[model samples]
Target: MKAEQKFMMIFRFTPNFKYQPTEAEMVQMQEQWGGFIGNIAIQEKLISTYQLGFEGKQIAADLSVSEGILISENKTLGGNMVVKANSLEEATTMAKDCPILKMGGTVEIRTITPMGN
Candidate 1:
């Protein structure tokens, strides 16, 4: 049997996001997210997930901590999901159906290397 590796799917969006969808659209997106995650859970691939909040504090290089979501356009760091897969290709194939992409967002997939390697 092939060993399963962990992958983190990071979701991001433009801070100044344009074209706010209607209430129905929002609901549909929410349902899509649920279905996506639910399918993974059913397949026993989901490890964990999180929804990042807008409010956050950042510690600068000088150790100066600043309040608020301190990041650039690429620093939105919206949400993430951890899943187990046999290879990067397999993990990426699973991420192809991500609803974030449909909403003009991005999904960044990163393999989680275990410590003490």
Candidate 2:
């Protein structure tokens, strides 16, 4: 059996990003996202996925907390999904179909290292 590893894809997008699509367009995009994730689930690769809420707070190094604001175009973490794959390349290939990419968003793939006992 092939060794499998878990990866987390961190999604980021511009705070000003907006989708002003028609009803049909909206439906199409929704279907696309569903299809993309559904396929992975069928393959037993999808672990979990969820959309992040916009309202959040930020903590500074000094432990100062403030309302979360987009510090940069790619600073806001929009969402994330965890998946299992045989390799980083495979995980990256899987993330290529993420709907966020079409919205000018970014996905940062990182391996989920096992915790030391």
**Model 2, which residues run further than 4 Å from truth?**
17-23
CA lDDT of 47 in candidate 2?
96
Report the C-alpha lDDT of model 2 over 1-117, residue by residue, as the tens digit.
Answer: 679999999988776547567899889978988998898999999999998887888888999999966557456788889999999999999999998898888899999977898
Q: Compared with the true structure, what per-residue lDDT tens digits does model 1 show for residues 1-117?
A: 789999999988766546778999879988999999999999999999998888888898899998888567664777999999999999999999988888688899998877895
Pairs clashing within candidate 1: none
Candidate 2 matches the true fold with a TM-score of 0.83
**Alpha carbon lDDT at 2, candidate 1:** 86
TM-score of each: 0.86, 0.83
